[model samples]
Target: MASGTSQAPEDGGVMPSRAPELLSGNPDVTPDAIRATEKKKVEAPYGQWKSDITKEALFRGSRKLLSPRVCSRTGRTFFTEARPDGIYHLVEASQSGATYSCHTVLPEGYSARSRVYEYGGGADDGKGDDGDAGPRVIFCNFSDCTVQILDVDTEKVTCLLAESDTLRYADFAAPPRPGSPWVLAVQEDHASAVPDQVRNYVVVIHTATGEVRRAVEGADFYMYPSFSADGGKIAWVQWDFPDMPWSGVKLYWADWNDEDGAVSNVEWVAGEDGMTVTEPRWGADGFLYFCYEKTNYRQFYRRRPGGDMALLDLKRYEEAEFGSASMFIGSHTYAILSKECIVAVATENGSDKVIAFNPETLQSQDLSLPLSEITYDGLYRLSDTSFIVIGGGDTTPQAFYLVDITDNDDGARDNRKLTNIRWSIDEVLNPEIFSTPQHIHFSAKSGPKREIHGFYWPPHNLEYKGPEGTKPPLIVQSHGGPTGHTGPGLALSMQYWNARGYATFAINYSGSDGHGKTYRELLNGRWGAIDVNDIAESVRHLSSSTSTPPLIDGRRVGIRGGSAGGYSVLQALCQHPALFAGGACYYGISDVKLLLQETHKMESHYVDFLLFTPGMTDADKEQVMRDRSPVHHAGNITAPLLICHGEDDKVVPISQAYTMYDDIRARGGEVKLVKFPGEGHGFRKGGELAQGA
Candidate 1:
């Protein structure tokens, strides 16, 4: 409790400044000696102490919960559970008078999963009219991408339509009504061509006849196909290659002929400038609502049926983004709550807020809740007063919750109600095991003094503390997506190191999305080089920190990351060969050109934006790719390295991992390789995850 002492957020961090006698500089009386003399509690080195939060404990009593949605007709909620064994089971929750009962809807062999663009989305939905015919649930079968419907009333799942391995469907949208017979969906046709040439189009499924017809087609990619309140018109998001949805996309709308389930007179609406527009939904007020970053941060925007697009004039939106990228299908952050109000997830500085706003006046208020991060497709409309969402917090894991709200846009406010229905993990460990993340701002030294955002977690454990006169080693984590972000919330990956007595810092570098589009574009044309500089500056900023006693030992440092972050780890080690003790890269990229050529259709041209300018010749672009790729510079890495990869990874092939390992080993650099069988992109099994730990 002393003034200059370092108090861990939850754990007793560094020992209080030694007694005054120890402060009295005496060469023979070392600080460690004085600290031992002044010690009043049991001394144990960090990371070596016994702790209850083991690596295996993360998944012991835990389950991986996917998207959750509520049926507007009957308040029936549906969500999916992903098991380590690879089957994604769909669960439906229905009210039994006063309680909700969750039951798995699929048989043992069927998995409700979508593989559109191979990134996978458009999995399941509990959409239907108020008629008692049955609650119709749309499910995409993982094994063969079949589009099936579950009749919850009879617990019978029947084929709405069947698909082959070459055909996948997702991003399903059903008009809100009483007797709509068809739903619109996006279809990915892989049998049509190779990876980049795969055919993507929008299709309409007629429930009565089980007939499928193409409604929109000939675009590189399509997403968010939506119909107006009366089903008279439709809107969808589209974009071409060399531009991802988060980078450049267009919003389009068309008149729908309900009798024939066909869209006509389709025309480009918004996104003329192509600035990251997505999730277009027509509000009850007859206005199309969506999230667009035209103003540099993806903010709330609404469009009249045939009028201009206008940004919501809310205060908070000036600093916060309404939603994230549309990398995968089936994710939506905002929902129309009523004719006067709409609710959306607003993200600012790595945190989330569910906000309610009026389309006419743009009056908005943050709904008070215990949730932290709301996953994609997390928001669903239950009624004008309530909704369902899946979220996790600092001390809580992910769970499904029913949120009820008073009208915030009606010129008044009241407390919001959040009811937990089911939890991914029910047991809460000792509070001492949690290390609250402290949001910190530092500047990248090599850049033009741009501020860098990150979260710093001090080593924390209920029973252990670092020995006197020493600081915890630092682990600088670079997050994936390069376009993605490391949020300010409870993350097992962030806390895993904290439980072991290591200080950790997660960087949301310049290209990260939560900040704003201006910052998000900072990595364009300078991915590898700029991100490396920012990370290096972060190490210096933390090492030479102005705190009473430095929080981390810069001399004993390591860099860790996965995917895009993994690539950063390798680049950081090579850029500052003498700065780190070692590095861990999980399915990280080693060759830039290989990634550009071999990545999925969604990101095939993403590296083009990252590594080259618009006018660069083919030769110049190739030179830059070679220059920025870490494998080309592996000889510069002096520290030991560990690399892990999934043999089935299509995003970044295992071949990339093999190439990096071979190059490092051939260069006489200390490197190790670990491979997981049947795992792709990310490890799912608890044992494999723990082994990497």
Candidate 2:
């Protein structure tokens, strides 16, 4: 490999000397030149050849597995799995002889999905078997957004409520009492002239009578309607406009009437003011346990009947997040085991672990599971010392595991054992081709030397190696949610790049979750600047020859992301054009001001926190928004770019991509735009995903 010289063009732009040579074609073609060209095309670079990890495999191989629930009476674990046919099936798994028998509980053509708030949650929940009613599962039908019940014995599916296009339901819970036919769920009604006028609240559905009645109303959003063990009390969480659940929420509880099926004496329990609360669960001891953020970190608190709330202190682990931001309903962070113990998942430094805390003693016992990270709301305690969780490591995909803590006679650190209940996908791809991520921390660009974190995955392939003395290209990935964290899981999409001779870096830039509140607020009023700088610095850090040999080729660095991450990619390229060779933006936001006006109601006020400053005039705020928008600076992005968007995306519409493509093309820059029909904010169909990959 030869080093290329950087030169300043007469147009006041920096240009590489090797750029012209790579783009120019020789006018005089000789027989030797033609032969050389043929040889170069036929022989591919090491690790760059097509392998078994094709685009189809990348999309179809990994199964969508989430929301694990255990039936206490039958000890059967059930979960939702998205099959290759685009239908989400409810699967039930029973353990036997070093393996598990898994069967689909839902009939053909039935999908357990919810579209409430666009990103649905609490799609399915099961009721334990009673002598009279037998076993049943309640779920939100994706086809009509109506609540449906499935009989475990008869396998008969029946709608609990009449199907209506204006009504959607999620986050369901059935009373623990046997022979109980009433189900509690959050309902969203869209029968209004104005979309923003739609009503959201909690409702009770009588399975036997097929009657749906409002249980709680007057709140903009409601979730997690839980019933106590005795069925005498109920609890839930609610939030209003201009404030997402992550920003603030209110927890409420009231007495339940089994005969009348109504709630009374409703009172605010916790999460008043601007505190964020989530996942309210009733313990066996008749105490209400929920997660709330009073300090900088989210932690668990318990409230006894007629008593004030008390913190469940895990003394050694005081700085971790006990609950995650409520992006969707059914975000379970903790579960009750017995009257004295609680099993919870806590996150620190962008990783998650399962811990058992005794509320009586206020001490935590570390359940040393084999996996490094656990999925959010994956913990379900079946017995006093036994539980099930979905988790994975750097090279492992998310899978279900049965964990037993009853044999913890040795101690807290090394007592528990885990049995793999099921894998998200069969291990068909070669493990040798998978690359493990190294957690890298580098200094922020303009902050007070604060550290920015990212996962760096180097190219790995057993069959091929890069050309001698040459570094592989790098792809910088920005995760969505701007508030969401990218965990160290073996994602097939990231591995696809690694297997194809590319180094990948996933940045958890400022404003990302898992970090403390102070670090998460680093992007407040500086969304584009802070995130873009962090991404650019990450690329520079990997490209510099700090090690014996650089891990990435600086001249071939590119950026890519979806949603908020896509916004970061576009801004990074426009702000630092010379640093990135090219970029790929999927449903990215190019104009902040436009997004603020057109985004969904759930995130309508989100831009106020990311872009607005206090006491700024309307004109001043508009200038700031335009100044940070990538569309306004498209001329600055000289590198080649690829933009993709779903035609039905409501969050960041396709017009954003079209405007960006047109702007870059008008400036004489290379650009391409691809739009998918019938797709929304995220691609779901296998064909669309394969093409995007």
Candidate 3:
């Protein structure tokens, strides 16, 4: 053979070219031929395609962590992170290299959660420094409903109150100074026979001796008990039955005699005549600040020591809500940073923003928040110009950010200084696969000039494209609290559908929160009728719109929701049978009358506002309840329905689902019911969620 040259074939045939040898594949297969074959494989259709956002993704140990609390003594921030194990861990934030490190503060199996009112809050609060011993923390344990103290120095957890399953405590508040040596909490007694007679009061627990004693009583319900900076005064909100906390509440304050350990000179300051008052905070200067809904909106108000209440002037800004309806125990909208400055979270058009206000000057400036949605009770003031908040945008699920407002010029410019220190998930998902929400406003036929709002999210899949010219199926989600508004935050469950080529729409119907008082009250005395109409109208508006993408199929729509939203789902499918292809109801109410009689004490009187008319007789109310119940009108439903209920649910009993299932099946309608054994109103167990998904 010649050096650096090709050799002759052994068979005496012409030698092949060097291209096939370099390619090193089938000799006859050219590069162009291989490329064509791969292209055909990419375009070929197999069976139905699956996505990475599978049921496992939906049931995975992902969580939406919130409630950031920074310790003044240690300068370390602590927050609760909920996980698929159905437990919440008190996490301490630290830094490692360029990444954040989360250290679990609580011991294994010790969940820092409260079951008060079944919506749990006020479970954790930072205790001020005890002399030179650093700051302590008081938290409620879900295991035994006992209040516990976490000693920062020792890293030891000790029960501040003896463990008792019958007695539950939440909404913790520590005195500003260690002289009191006690923590204030709301105590809920579950041993009472009469639901109305259950004892709920503000109590004080001795930090050292673990002794608990009543601090304030004489009210049907008490929540958010807060001590003044001097520890010489205390304030809280109370409400009676036939009225929810959001419907009406009285703000009361009393002079505290710390030496004698008594409350005296108590007086009802505000909240009368079905007015809602919440988040009563005492400023450093002794003025009591709170959110009051006297007008159509819940606005920020401050009352001087002996003067009347006045609204903080925010007329220059667009009309918005300063506070959320008191649905849970620790729902806070604003935090008083100093006597003159306050940081508040407000909602407008289904989005939330942080604002800094000068209570004295009545001047306000919007803080440039990176996220469109701020979690309730997420704002914590670290200083006059700095704070920490838990929020999420269209792509970020939920994360903690240190926000600085020192540069805010009180103008329209983006003055927010933000730094992300921690995330809810360990690994960040691809943002391209997440669907961003588009705010849509549509008019409803039933309400005439009334407009309905919703967040419309189109399907997004970076790797997959649906069959050409085929529209995606639509899923209309009804939020749990008909009073709850669906904000424009990234939701993994919503993204799961979007990634799988399904469009999702979350409706803030007539009765949803965040749209001011008038909108929230739209479902009053017309719950089933108005909510159903608004949901149907939202679907109809999207289906008939010319701007809708061809990828959205008008005729293929489904509805799903839990609790109040589930009720709306069932009602909408029953009333507008031809509008939906299927529906999913989770722990939904099928009988309003039964719900009124058998529901939990916290919501026992909720039906009075939903189904009752002032002048109607008992018979009339009963007839109306029956007429509005989906179980009674199962024959009207034509769409296939799936009903899932927690067997232990007390808010909307499993019986509600059972009755609806039987009624629809007896009517020869398409229906299926699934029950989760150890679940409640909401499924928290990992196995349960996996099974349900």
Candidate 4:
């Protein structure tokens, strides 16, 4: 990593004397009611404007609605909802006459969450009709970290797999046979001889006997244990250490023996070292469907039972990705609708949209969706033509919708006929005060000289405006995952700050998804340096030279982010202290070495590919890591810093925060550290979020 500081001038109490440039994500749609000068408005300085949005309102509306699981037999869709009160509920949504309703179906204190890879996903699966027993969902109980089954209708809890201190299971797959006793899942054995050497394999769980038996074993990691329609064969994906799921994986199919639980004759179907294989799904027609990248995009592909794997049709839009860089198990980018058709989440240019494909003919088209602009959390195949998906757009908050394409013609692709039911829209959002984010692309100042992607939200509130000729204070956010993307979605946090007359720019940086694989691979072996330089460039690009009138006050600019993003916040403050006035880091990495030891099993080796260059010796890597570690340079960061960490976080341990705080405070630097108890890598409770905000 280079020790060079930014050449951009420092923020020496110099206020930018021009109005911030307002860029709209939607320029042609509606008249600007937020900036209507004719309306009487409260005049105030930037970053201090007052509006209806408050911390209480911002967090009260925040709910984690994800992991949508649908039961075809019961016509009910299940979703995991994490509320501010700290109870994680398995919410069931079913359609009534003209509307739909969602309510919790899980027992009290029973949360439908997974802890497999430490950053758990793939914790629950719903299918099978158990006669008078009704629909049931099998999930990993977060309380004891065990696998359990819950009867959806009766709300009865049954133990399928016993609790284990060393074993964790996720990405469950149940046989298609009604009332089948067998289901498959990816099981992780954490009781390895070497603590960090967590072993991963597949197992078959006997629902009737409450017994878990090994089915398949070999890979360093396993995911999506999908069974064939007839339950004779199974298909799954596997990857090894040093390669993230998005980097490389292999798909395999095998024979399943009913007499004794075992998977045999496993054969590699697809995937290679450079390619990424997503959730392997078995269509009703017995074809295995998945997404992988051979070129620059993760295109769709499917394999027939005894035929070679072939690419599915993208309908001439092959440049877009049919799948995403899925980080967790049970992540669905596409679902097998039928042998003829499949509905998938296609990401293009940093936006998510649903694209329906004719797999046999290799043709696809954009679905006529009401929330057509942005879709996330993947698609669930409920029936042959109807699938439940979570989608939203620039003006739309993320909501649940049951898309029924059975009645629509191929040409119209209409969305009005689609069933959009009840959502987590408890808060009434006034569109007049919401500041829309406009997509902005700028060049990096150093290292590679490529385009960087981000969104700019100009401060907007119908009731307030900044006085005179001063621009707004900018919050340049570095999103988590570092592999994550920031788009123009309706975010209450962004709006709350905007209502307070604070301009914000969220940069996708170099390694963000939705872009091609080439762009995503840019962070390979140069995580902190590349991402930090991009952050500095984001402030420099928007603060002065690029925008005509300059969209922000360079002197009052700050940075905030969490997880990997928090790491960037620290690096941004340390590497380019002059560019940022302050920084807020939440559960961020302080020392690269600490991260190597403290992070979870799934992301343990991720640092190797992200920051360690190929062929670098262990000693060489350590030297490089120490150079980039924020803990080593805390004494040099003069900017006021706020560090927040969940005490229960297993990913980036709380020790990282405490260590950083002590080092910085020992050097007489301005710093504050706050801990949220009973929280994990990310804050879930409303009060915790509000306090952190």
Candidate 5:
């Protein structure tokens, strides 16, 4: 990797000073009044915020925060940390059972390839510094895989799969494929594959020969490949264009043709089966276990060849959403971490039970960590026993952890941190006054089993406790993805707001992940309904109880969100105009009908899944689209709203914001429109949009 010290001055741009500070509460809203209202909101059956604050507190604690340049895996003793120096360093400790070492591998002339995407490699150890033994990596540069590999000895580029779009490390093809080691790479080409040729082929590369072999091709798109135990085959999931990977996809497999030195006999494994198979893996015995969503809930399942897919262990709860956790990568099974017998990350029934199952014994265990809330990403296994986990929940930033399975039998254990991820954010956060979040859940309606989950942070002061006991105002936040879940990860944003004296409520609405497929699908065909209720329930929770965070003047509540969250914000304003006093939306979907027509090729048909319509006809599409569109109902939105968009946005066109602004203004609604040229669905050109948005 080229030295990044020279480039740090340019890439490490200084933070801006004019950032908008978070408001603690309404200026006129007294602390005493807030305390009184809290009790009322809690006593009122409709108020859910009080319980939310209490629950938020349940999931709070210190978390690891690291730089964005690196990624970590579970089960690995050490984690990979990408430095501003343009190098990825492998750090491990013996207590975790993985050795630590740094390798400098970069291709020549790369002159500092952007560290946009880099993932760490687990120890294969004997391979040597030059891609022989040490750590391996799988990363992607927006242009290609060039940013992923660098020569440890020379810090020079060693392996660059320029032809491949992205690369990710999977459990070594079990038993190790002979001749050359194999890793999966998702590649795209305009030609070659048939049926549908949008993204082309899935390539399996031979590390020794630099030979790239096509495994499977011809689909709208595919990602997340896993190797079957025998090393003779591969299993992966595929979904077509316009459909988000989570909505629905098909699982597939292919046999290796040793003589041909490539993949042959490609076919979908139970292709038409009505199941959403995610995180597929093959156990040592060759049984395929994967998480599947059916009947509105996501559950893990195992399948033996020629046998039916059977559910392993699962939780069916209408009150508590399950399957909200996302598995960035998967292995055959998770190693036990704490003596508590929890799965560490994948818990069953909220208990930390050691799940040793029959070939069909599906057991679940919950591993409660020090933090009350958490959001984890990538998983890695080290020496096939220990585990390393990445990504932290709300209070924690992306940190790497080392868990020794051997210690699980004893109740006394402390998972060691290989690096201090918190160091990165400590300078920015005021530790003394940081407020912890409380977790809470509430029923969506009068008697439905469905519920919403969220964490609420109450206002705090450095010196003054309160003026004879006062409560703080609150900001209800609806998370992005409309499909994504709200994990217990700490955010500078949340702390910044809390320090300023405002309480913030961030909720995982009905369709959010963690609660399984059924809850995940609640938003489907009912996007406007469930999402709206989830937010309202949060407000009710806050306004009614002293046990919860204090509420500001009911007339002064405000809301802000981006993308799907932005859509929710717009929806809230239209459906409950008096609920939020002000709203800010960033790249939110403004028009359901327009989004269906103008979305990127990768997600062109996604609206069909959410809106519950084929979207095949103009009239049918228009009706459903109009029903959910906030823009269509803008005339009724009385709250003042700030709209921000990227000029080049394709996910949700910039025009969506413009059209809404024009219409709202035409109808005498307060609105602000901000536009950035040469931008896309997301902001990339620094804080320009952040400043305006």
Candidate 6:
């Protein structure tokens, strides 16, 4: 929904309230004879009456998030797990003080003939009951992954727990242990090879008697479950495979025996003390916490049951890195909501900070604001001083922020601001205003001062004070998790090439993500030689700037991106075809050896760690994926490309931009392609490929 805008919506929306009297075809036609016949067929490009600044004035000095639904102090009748075809309604706080609302959680031909998936609150089912008064649900149904149950005081579905065809990952648990309602599920034993060759476990369901009772297979590979407070026992998470869950993982715990309700001794504790733990939970005197990331920097731990896990900011000059641009740290503990207080989230590399902590005197304050973007979901302790904090970021959107924490965390008890979802971008379009980005560091043609994170914007209404100093055509831009990066924000095609004047830039190079882990493993096996020498050393440091000397037009350079920044914009335009003149590629991937033979199945073995051998040898990974393909050097491409695609893309497949558009039009070059239709691999739909994006 952020694809700049294309205009549609006249009185009832999607253009047509007599289009300004049919563009004055003649009501005696004379709004200066219909703007002199639309300025003789359309040629007002010069300042075109100026003033253009609104999308509420570039979002009113925007730090964004002016409200679009978010409310859950847990009382809106607590319980929702993504719009499962009907039955959703949070409506109650709107008056701009906004709270939350949704209505249809199940009830349209009963959600087009039921069979939903991923429902919630089985919360590691052991079936608790201290104060428990009704309301609890769970769902799953890839037609037959079966395990449904619902009962928000009669919302329906009430039974049927396990019917597994070998279920896969499940949840629910962590409260005051009263044999609390359990339902964990996770199954295996049906291998067809691949997906790390198979071996998975965890079962336990009991949702009030659909019993299956026990099955916690081990020796590595349990699958994220989480519970252990009162629901007797059951805490999950395991890792194995080309390691990802951030390279290392583990965290176990099992005990629940309430007679024969299952679970049994199980162990492991905080990721086997080797580090790299992750989510965990437990708190309120029980002790557990989580998030480790070995030493590559992620922090926060606690443990304590038998005792000795500690680490909370163990000081390397008190280092801290919270969340953003995620390659890890999606959760960092702290959601208690209250006893003294706890609402935490703290990432210093992708810049996030919602703070509040206490966890019994660990003390910290901060509560977000000052360029606000706090995204820390889950935490709902209604009183002892309020709390909600659901999450929102990057110009904020996912709303829900009740906050009180015994007041004076300063945002004046941050009362309510949660518009009931469905958002609007005022039909998007006033973008183009960039300017703040300069972080340069250079020096790595292979060496290593290597700090490369870029930005540079400039170019609207062109002029660094022109009179004969006209330079603007740049573009550069490139980012697609070749481990990911390129931050700061506003990207309406870098504001339509900065409002048609051009000059863009982007960078983040050498395996991005706020520089850590040996500069992100220096792009592991050097992804296309460290992003073509970090975009040719950010265009030779802006053509050797000395206080912005080169406002770019180095002979009109250009290059665009998508997916792995369209494989670093077709390997930086076929490895510098005399420094780019035009490039566009949206669904990028001109053959990493046919992307390791047509990808998917979660990157079928991820080109054996991004380049070769998840089973290589198709003539040595198709000549190293056609020597890092750009349609194998589309006859040394003379630039002017464009490409873009979607036609139901399943991630870079419109046959990899129609095989780089029939190999750059059979090598005559100067491509074009375009496509779009129904859209996927993410362009998001509306029409005419949302008006050509």
Provide TM-scores for the models: 0.90, 0.89, 0.89, 0.92, 0.72, 0.30
Local distance difference test, each candidate: 0.77, 0.77, 0.76, 0.76, 0.52, 0.51
- Tens-digit lDDT track of model 5 for 79-102: 333342223333332222233322
TM-score, predicted candidate 4 vs. hidden true structure: 0.92
Write the residue-wise lDDT of candidate 1 on 1-693 in tens digits.
Answer: 011322211110112222222213346657786456546434577656555556665654345676777776766777777754566777776666646656676666688878787778768775558477757788888777888887766767788777675778888877776788878889888774556788888998887788889889888989888888877898998888778878678888999987888789988887855487877877778888888877878877888876887878787578888865857687878888898778888888877878888778778887766566788778878888888887776645566777778744546547576666665542444433578788888666675668888888998765567787888888899999878887765676667778778889998888888888888888989999888888888888888855445788888899999999999999999889888999999999999888877787777878877888879999999899889889999999999999999998988999999999999999999999999998888776655566666
Give residue 246's error in model 1 in angstroms.
1.5
lDDT of 4 by residue, 1-693 (tens): 111112211111111111111112335445464335535777788877777767866565456667788776766778877677666778777656755656678878688778888777877887465766678888899878778889877889888777888888888887877767888888889887353588988888888887788777767888888888888899888888878888788889999876666788988899999788887778777778788888898887778878988876566668787665566777776777776667887777676677776766666677745453343454788877778787665655666667777535653335423555434434545454678778888777676968888888999876677887888999988889878787677777777788788899888888888888989889888898888888887787788857878989889898999999999999988888888889999899999898888777788888887888879998999898999899998877989999999999988999999999999999999999999989898887886677666
What TM-score does candidate 2 reach?
Answer: 0.89
As for TM-score, the candidate ahead, 1 or 4, is 4
**Which has the higher lDDT value, candidate number 4 or candidate number 6?**
4
Clashes of each: 0, 0, 3, 1, 95, 45
Q: Which candidate is the best by TM-score?
A: 4
Candidate 2 per-residue C-alpha lDDT over 196-310 given as tens digits, one digit per residue, 9 for 90 to 100 = 6778989888877878889999988888898988889999988887667777798999999989898999989999666788888898887899888888888888897799999
Off by over 4 Å in 4: 1-39, 193-195, 368-376, 406-410, 691-693
**Two-way lDDT contest, 2 vs 3, winner:** 2
The pairs that clash in candidate 1 are none
